[model samples]
Target: MPKNKYSLIRYRVINRCLRERRYVTLQELREACEKALDISPLSDRTIEGDISAMRHDSGLGYFAPIKRDRINRVYYYEDPDYSIDTIPLNQDEIESLVFAAKLLEQFKEIEIFKTFTDSVQKLVDVLNIYRISGMDTVRNFIEFETVESNKGTERLPELINALKSRTVLKLRYKSFTSKKISSHIIHPYHLKEYRNRWFLIGYNEEFKAIRTYGLERIISIDTEESKKFIDIGFDTKKYYENVIGISVIDEEPQNIQIAFSEMQAQYVISQPLHHSQKRLNNIKDKIVFEYFLIPNYEFYAQVLSWGAEVEVLSPKSMRDSIKQYFDSILFKYNH
Candidate 1:
């Protein structure tokens, strides 16, 4: 085999060994590589050379952070995400990547993705180097509206790190109704984004409930390395599956019916209110839409946003709630 082929084979064997076993001795790696590749067992010197190349080879520079255990003479990758396969992209792959990167760049002004500014720029530079005129045409022609930056975006990286590592975080949070900032130790399970605002859903140690905190209202975050993270077995997808937005209430989904005017119904037909939205009735100028949701604050707020264009027809409780909300607004204006 050619030298390049041999090196590729060696890199593959080494990567496979590292991924399969947390730590592997030189002898163990040689045996595994021999078995997997059906090649002769590599000498100790050859294995050491392979490990060094994986850590420092310019073309395949993985920066693997492979560490050696002095006592047991074993090696393992310190960072699990580090991989040699992510070396470079081919021309077509790079084009597609640039397309996606530019699309995501539309939202780069948002704090959540702002941290990727340097990285995305670097990617753009790489793409630019390999880009053809067609790619540029595709990129320049498309555009997205840049929205205003939301608060607590600077802390996105820290919060994401906490969630990834399952590290307990001490948060200084100020709720919308609260006057003073309160401190709570939380085990962050998931980070969510809704309407440009970022939120952390986690189990609050003091409150003893899985609560959601807007990243904007978060005053500060301190990682509690000393505290062990607790997994409350919260299913984020399942949690928000029945709801429209982040505000989750401890209630079952109720069948919600809303009647909309012909003009508004056309818009709703094209852009659904929720995944659960379905047309229940349409007679003359009125269209009735049905949805199954938890009727959380977000749902009510959404209904309110439609104003006189929408009317809740069923679920007396929710209808009453909507009525009171409008009544209060009217009272404020009337007073």
Candidate 2:
């Protein structure tokens, strides 16, 4: 372990002793930390320094009220009830926690999360307690974009189980463009979410290739008990590393350059489109940005969402594709 980890362990040990034991001697604290970590005897000087740091280190945020009895040479907390475990949270932190609790409440009815139901309830109870105790300043300051009629979230438990047990799945799916439903035998690899939609990414047995299926389009899902589960050893991170959203193509990543209007540039700078995005240069009134990514349907749609405020500078193929799309739109309007 690192030196900081050891120090943290020592601090926890000291805190436990101060909270539980009375008239704890400096020697006793050292012995306790050494025994807990199963290490060599810690010196008295080291123990004293630990106590000093715990009491005065503002970075630690644990300005423990520690005092010593001169007569008995014993140390203890001035407030018996004081413990690091019950550290006070600031108003902003409390509000953020309350908001998170609200989000977690949405998943309470899901079967897989039944174990966490009690934990989530406990958090709500704590928040309520805080509210009754005069910290009732928590408000609905943040709102999340939610899909009211989102489908397939109920399949999360079964999908998660199949992923864990390496179970093959039989999925009946219908695409947005298709009227007929198709059945597929898939080796479940991963479940992904993008823009309030869930998708199943897996190895399609019939297609003999990896494919993505939107959960909203799924009609039914069942276990393929007869088929043996084939694991492709999918590295989720590496697979989606270069792509924006959930569409992962087989092509190599392109050096994508885009120029954004000044207004849109501010938003891009604040919340970057991709991890690989970097500011290239300023041209006229536009801010040029660079991204190393595999162009996909989602990438095109994202660029299109900004409309005229953003322009794809290079990879002529991508630029032409966007131009063709605009031309088609113009042709439709003109016709």
Candidate 3:
């Protein structure tokens, strides 16, 4: 506020002008400033002073150079190079964006990541222009729901830097099958967002294998300096194109069917059980969703979330396992 009132008003005018117009006459700009900001009187003398202060005083890098023609005179923001390259969201994309931002806000651990954006002010500006504020900012207007897997969690920030710099990771992994802890040196190939959480798919250097490690499951990660990555052979995306649950499959993934009852069909449709889920039919009172995925615990858990509402319809092995899991749970609780 050490800046005088004129200087502050000048910055606002230039910001508004740059935002609204690429080319504007001095007269047009004067009227816009008066109308938008309610200046008591519009005079070229005051406007000229504002323009001068806009360039020298404000750090916004706004420049208003005067243009003259024999028939007319005008003023325009000097640089029209407002690149959309660095822009994160436009006026139309704020709602879903706000929802995602709020979800990340929960992970208090991921506060270390750097985003070159003024997201708060930008979101507020867009919402304000449309007269959206308060709880309506998040409530029902936009939502993010995760279809969590039984896959272990990793420390998110640790993986973020590894992904950013394309570095290898030394991890203390808790293998879900054996419940064994071991050290792994992995050359991270990709970081993907599925169901709200981030997953890293990489080549495990220790086992000479490929594995998908959930950002939340990473018990601890240390940046490995001595082990150098000479080559990363596989493309991250194509590696998981067939396998659904990141099970490190041996055979090609097969199509499977799942049937959900009317009671929990809404929740099934709300958060897709998998990225490839497709509605096969809505037969009278039941809903069926199908997808191609490896038969894994994560897939089993997806169906289990529906409790009595869902039943595996195909792949005999999966159906039997689902029955046994419930039977065990029932036996334990019934006693």
Report lDDT per candidate.
0.83, 0.86, 0.65
Q: Candidate 3 — worst ten consecutive residues by lDDT sum?
A: 108-117
* Colliding pairs, model 2: none
Q: How close is candidate 1 to the true structure, as a TM-score?
A: 0.66
> In model 2, where do residues sit more than 4 Å from their true spots?
1-93, 106-122, 132-136, 147-149
Error of 2 at 1 (Å): 23
TM-score for each model: 0.66, 0.73, 0.55
Worst 10 residues of 1 by lDDT: 131-140
Q: How do these models rank on TM-score, best leading?
A: 2, 1, 3
Candidate number of the best lDDT: 2
Candidate 3 — which pairs collide?
A: 152-217, 153-216, 153-217, 153-218, 154-215, 154-216, 154-217, 154-218
- Across 1-335, the per-residue lDDT of candidate 3 in tens digits comes to 15666556655765567557766677776787787667756787777767675545434333344333435465554555542223344434566666555665344333443241356446545555553444355624655553343333335556667777878788876755657777778888777766556677888876787777766666778888777873567776667665555555666677888878876777768877667789899777888888886766556666777687777888787788888998999999999
Residue-by-residue lDDT tens digits, candidate 2, 234-314: 889988999999888789998999999999999999999999999999999999999999988888989999999999999
Work out how many backbone clashes candidate 2 has: 0
**The best candidate in terms of TM-score:** 2
> How far is 33's C-alpha from truth in model 3 (Å)?
31
Model 1's number of clashes is 0
- What C-alpha lDDT does candidate 2 achieve relative to the native structure? 0.86
User: In angstroms, how far off is 330's CA in candidate 2?
Assistant: 1.6
